[model samples]
Target: MSGKRSIFEEVGETTPRREAPQGGMIDKGRGRARSAIRLWLMVLFALVALMIAVGGLTRLTDSGLSITEWKPLTGALPPLTTADWEAEFALYQAIPEFQVQNSWMQLEDFKAIYWWEWGHRQLGRVIGLVWAVGFLAFLALRKIPAGWTGRLVFIGALGGVQGAVGWWMVSSGLTGTMTDVASYRLATHLGLAFVILGFIAWYIFLLGREERELMQARRGKEAKLFGLATGWLHFAFLQILIGALVAGIDAGRSYTDWPLMGGQVLPPSIWLADLGWRNFFENPGLVQFIHRITGYLLLAFGIMVWMRGRRSANSATGAAFTAAFVALCGQVVLGIATVLYGAPWQVAIVHQVLAVLLWVLILRARFLSLYPLPQSIRRA
Candidate 1:
């Protein structure tokens, strides 16, 4: 045994040195799949965003109902031969969209719209296949993180529902005198898409961080900021649905003026529909008005959220909110421009894409509110 040294003696003589320990088994495996899972989710995110943009283009080109049947398995393969093209065109010709509105279109014209709708459906199939393959591969490898299995499965389930809802929206315009899908159904379809997008985004945010860091950050969560962000997110989502309503019935094209619709505080034709509620969904004037007013309110609330977010102790959190608020401002301006230009396809698609950017920004801010990144104390 080593002898104990006197107080003034060389203290290093009696001190024992030990080896530095390595990570324990518990820490070794936890969140091992986070990076891989995050990469998979990122791919899904891009595909879904592209899907939404393509969907908007499909609607803008009046091609949504061109493919009248929901043959999920068979629909993935686009028409190849001349006979196959004719068969598909015949099915479309039987729909109200073709008979009532595009009777003048030749087989060639029919093929134009057919390709857009086909591409849109084909993208959806690709997204589903990606989700299935990634999830199954992770599960098979036992690499999926604990507490995340259900969340991953939920994304797949929403994708399935989206496919069903897409068909439902398309089916609406197939019968009777409807030259387009019901406005409300279109809104529902778009709303579900946003919801799915939201979930994927939130998951991506969570997975961007380590479980240990996330747990530690939770102690410093800005509750008020999180709450405000949550409110703003919901309000923004509602506005998106309202915007979809406007898009569904081409309301943005009804008014070529901004701040005022048809040179009035409210369009003179705001309540022209036979039923009051129908006016909300079917009246281009009323629908556009609601979309405008809600957009204004959404901006107002977003500003308040930003003001609060700017005061967060964490600089990263503040930066996120600032970006979101800036996008919100840009979106409002774009909305005005879309109205002024009568919702031209180019301007309208830009506006749609901006809305998506703003959505992700708000989600990022909300995530930071719940899990703020540590910042240096050098700032005053």
Candidate 2:
């Protein structure tokens, strides 16, 4: 003003201004949405665990053979009236399991078992619907983060394939050759379900990891611990598969004693059958013995993992090790009880439930090890 310069020119000459970076709001919103997706995935994983447990109950109850038809849509709705009940029961009557093994069973008795099978199938339908709705919602809202959509889609496809596999398993028991599903098919189906659950759990872990802030603290040790945890996860999954084989062929029912079968450390003539390989998986006594041996091996591995973790008490890996140790002990006891109890429905179901829980714990340890939280964040 003293020099009589224009106001605008005076301001421009006094200071240069720079525009701040834009799009920060969008980035932050995207991050929040991704976090939400991660939490949702964890919820989905919990539901899967429940489904697996329920399926185990169904198997233990001998209710798998109750529902003889594959009616995806119509079967979703249970019998609403007496006529409907009769109609469903008539369909079951035609099945080999009913005609051959359970011909004396009355309609009322059939209904009791039918409800269990119906509940299992209905749960499957619910899971399918829930997955579909969640997926569509995520897609429509653009909530799923980049680099994850394809994996989720693949998981959804697997769910569909699992339905077909379920039917295929049921079909094996409907004909003249077998009264129950093929042990191989049963193992395949159970193994695939576990795989699907594992994938979901891992994806959730990845999502949570991205939201964490990076720290300057040393991570080399943590990284190695994570690798070890991942190994345990893989080993636990393999053990579960072997357990499934034991369940599929009723192997657990055949062997009641622990540490030894028929008063021998190694049951003599375990492979007495004509075909050697067939004996391992097919013969009931051999299969049971192998499963027992595998259990011992799994316990040994778990103990080693726990001990190594204990040696490094300051690390998160130690906590994971402790958890695996506890779970392994619980699982062993449950296995023994299940065997000693003649695989009673209740105890057997609990054993299966524990196996699934051990699997979840192993997965959680691996995730935590891979993406450790900074001490500052932990404290906060």
Candidate 3:
């Protein structure tokens, strides 16, 4: 028989509680926390989409250079009083864009363009604030999942750099003979925007499922299919950049015919510009020609990828690529229509939105190729 004689004696040996793992190894129990982060990222993703739409509208309306200053803090407030409006208009008037192109505009006309630019910049500010608050809160609370801190931080950093790049793009038209920003600069700005969007989308996909699920799904990875889809993604991105260049120089408005430029296979004097190299950037004929060729190539490559994706054992993965291919065809049709219609603001904006949609779809297909979802087979 056992006897507990002393009241002050310890009853048993105490054990220390195990602490949760950190530094890139997430605790599997943190599913709820991961979901929260994904939701936050989704919010940011939507805002960025809006920002891109507004940006497209701003360019179409020729309002990008309306705001002559980059006040990251104070610029949030629009011109309130008449005097403020006049001051802002005066600043714009000092710029080459106004002096050369919009010289006929009055204060009221300036106000219309100013509001477009102001709204675009304001949306950007909101995005930055949202990122800052969310990131800091998660960091302070130590709720960020392992290996995600740096990825999230990188997005914020890109945003800050993008702000600087925006100013840089604007400054290009403020002086010199340029009535608009350089086409290459515009492409850089837009390219970075898509890059940020792509990262956010990829992160959302990764976080949608549990870590264990992703790891398990990786076992049946379609290595060849993933490689092909990745190549397709890169090609699509390149096409987007080419499209940006087209928009920047108003190249789409140069020819109003599909499958032909000025009723010919290729427009005359494609390389007759003073600077042979500059023709690729400044010559509407050459730029649009390049864009068209690239589009055809992208379509062909996408079809190849889709064919491979159709063989995916996972139905969901197969369906994703199918959807992506459908979107691509629709986008091509929209693009052709836009060109034929002289790239009107309404049609052009729709084209841009479709491009974004297509991009996300391709990314989804590529992702599944990397991490396929498991499906249970039913017994006969």
**After superposition, candidate 1 runs with Cα above 4 Å error:** 1-27, 30-32, 376-380
lDDT of 2 by residue, 264-311 (tens): 877665776586787866777888887787788888888877776666
- Against the reference, the lDDT scores of all candidates come to 0.90, 0.77, 0.91
Off by over 4 Å in 2: 1-27, 211-223, 272-276, 312-314, 376-380
Candidate with best TM-score: 1
The clash count for each model shown is: 0, 0, 0
TM-score of each: 0.93, 0.87, 0.92
Error of 3 at 49 (Å): 1.1
lDDT of 1 by residue, 1-380 (tens): 25755677765656797878764433367565888999999999999999999999999999899998999998888889999999999998898877778999999999999999999999999999999999999999999887899999999999999999999999899999999999889989989988899999999999887777788889889899999999999999999999999999999999889788889998999897477778988998889999999998998898889999988888899999999999999999999999998899999999988889999999999999999887622276
* Cα lDDT of model 3 by residue, 272-343, tens digit: 648678998899899999999999999999888999898788888999999999999999999999998999
Error of 3 at 62 (Å): 0.2
Pairs with steric clashes in candidate 1? none
